[model samples]
Target: MKPLIVKLGGSVITNKRRRFTVKRATLTRLARELSVAKGPLVIVHGGGSFGHPVASKYGIAEGYKSKDQLMGLSLTHRAMERLNSYVIEALQKASLPAIAVQPSACAVVSGGRIQSMELTPIQKMLALGLIPVLYGDAVPDLSKGMSILSGDQLVVQLARELGGKRVILGVDVDGVYTVNPKTNKNAELIQEISLSNWPSVEKRLTGVVEGRDVTGGIANKMRELLALAERGVEAEIVNAAKPNILKRAILGEVGLGTRVVAR
Candidate 1:
């Protein structure tokens, strides 16, 4: 069976408002939920408080411009690694054979877009019944010295390359909203997003929420997932902050979140 690509959004896994804070209880619970999965899985995670701040401070996403940014690149990659370690620990505590796959060491990008990535290790890990955990990290860019690779973009790449049939995005919200639900009382949940209605939905999405996300936030996520949808890989954005939702979403339960489809 093709592996399912699961993304643990930075906002859901960590306290994005605070720097470097991991929601331990939430992480542990989610790990336990993931342990119930019975098929091949590739887990990708966002940087949240861990990586975004450091990268933003150095303008790392704008690409390499000076020697001054060298430290930021190192620091950004280190921050992501630190976060990845926490995820690895949680997965292992749940008795899942999870291994960290450093995207910085394996991926190369051009203009902040993935040009190529080493996938053999991930492929082998699945064959061995192991889950490969990847995260957003600083990577070498052909045009710029380096750039930030978002987990959203990584999900699309992995799903396309690995022949994944489904992608589950675990975010803090219930799903895509007509507006930023956190700040708007009138915002309604969008149950489904398709190519035909995407143009209209795109207009309703607000800019990045009050956070240091350099990955273009929800707007970027929608764009990337839409591209994947065009390729026939269905994706769902669900509220992972709530208990059991992520587990059900991963288990193929529908209607709990906004479904993004080609049609």
Candidate 2:
């Protein structure tokens, strides 16, 4: 049984461009499916349409301003918590034992590195057969004051630390593509990527999307997360919009997605 770390993309949950509202049916289905999974599980989700656009609207994206940053941070944190509660409750209703642990509360990042990850509690819960859920939000940083930690980045770090044999990142697209599939119909899904070939992938990503889009985006995410694969931690990017893919990935069954592994 591999230690599974599944990242729930914000876009899949909420339409951030509009306003933050719970995608009730999707979350309900996800919770139902995850409840019966047979393995140690850790879940992370993005802020989606709820917190991010608000932060961007108030200029919170450019690192937090002391005053507005705090306000923005408060808003962002609350929004994530709201989503977290909804997920947790749904999981509970589905008979899945789960707990929500806010990374900002116990995680400490110094000099842009995860200096420490206090995982004893999470480990304890997982050992007791409870799923631990984390999300992307504002976390404290010694140098930058407060920083936004994407759920994607958090999963990469957690997968490395937990030594998961594989990490499956469910995203909005088919998989890592040569171009944003939305804009470029010609974009082809690349089956595999390595750290060495990432430069070429990054170069080809011009204007199809923003860096942050690529932050959680498959190509760039696979690049940053390649270190885990180097250590023999397999990873993949799949479309989260699909209803049943998560269950397939959890079962170690082949499903739609680009698999990223060590070359």
Candidate 3:
């Protein structure tokens, strides 16, 4: 079987309004749930409170400003480290042999995009029955010196390289909707989306509710998944803000979330 790509969104893992805070109980529960998966899992996570705040302030995503931006980049990396450490510890406590890998160390970025990703470490980790956890981070950019790469972009790269047929995103919302549910009361939950209706669906999406994200947020996520769908890979979005939904999605359950089908 091909490896599964799962993304733990920042909204699901942390309080976006709170600075540098993680939802430990939710993460631990998710780890325990993921511990039972029988297939190889490549987990990619968003920056959430840890990365987005600092990077947004420094315009890191804008890419290669001055040496002054280096301070913001350094601070972003440190925050990612701290957040990843907590996640790794939680996964380990759940008996999942999860290892942390930095995207900047292996992936080459240029023009705010990943030009190349070194997948050797991820392959080896999966072969050894371990989970490889990747988080959004600032990476060297040939065009600008460095750029903030989003986890959504990493999911597409992982799925393409690892022979993944599906990419799952656990977010705060139950699934993709016709409008921003957080604000619009008439927003309808879109149970399924595919190439045929993607253009319209893309029109309905609302960007981030809170938090400073240099990455394009949900808009970026939709475009990335749409690209994957065009390649015959499907992406699922489930509600991770609550509980148990993420575990269920990881277990390959369907009908509980929105499914992005190939056109």
Best by TM-score: 1
State in Å the error of residue 228, model 2: 0.8
Higher-ranked by TM-score: 1 or 2: 1
> Cα deviation of 243 in candidate 3 (Å)?
1.9
List lDDT for all candidates, in order.
0.88, 0.74, 0.83
lDDT by residue (55-84, candidate 2, tens digit) is 666554455466867777788788879888
Taking the tens digit of each residue's C-alpha lDDT, what string does model 1 give over 1-263?
A: 78999999898888987899999999999999998788899999999899999999999999888898999999989999999999999999999999999988888789999999989989999999999999999887999878988888889999999999799989888888877778789888989988999999888877333233788767667777888999989999899999999999988898788999989
Predicted structure 3: clash tally: 0
lDDT of 3 at 213: 63
In model 3, the runs with Cα more than 4 Å from the true position are: 206-212
Please give the TM-score that candidate 2 achieves against the real structure.
0.90
TM-score of 1: 0.96
Where is model 3 poorest over a 10-residue stretch in terms of lDDT? Answer: 205-214
How many clashing pairs in candidate 1?
A: 0
Clashing pairs in 1: none
Give me the displacement of residue 23 in model 2, in angstroms: 1.3
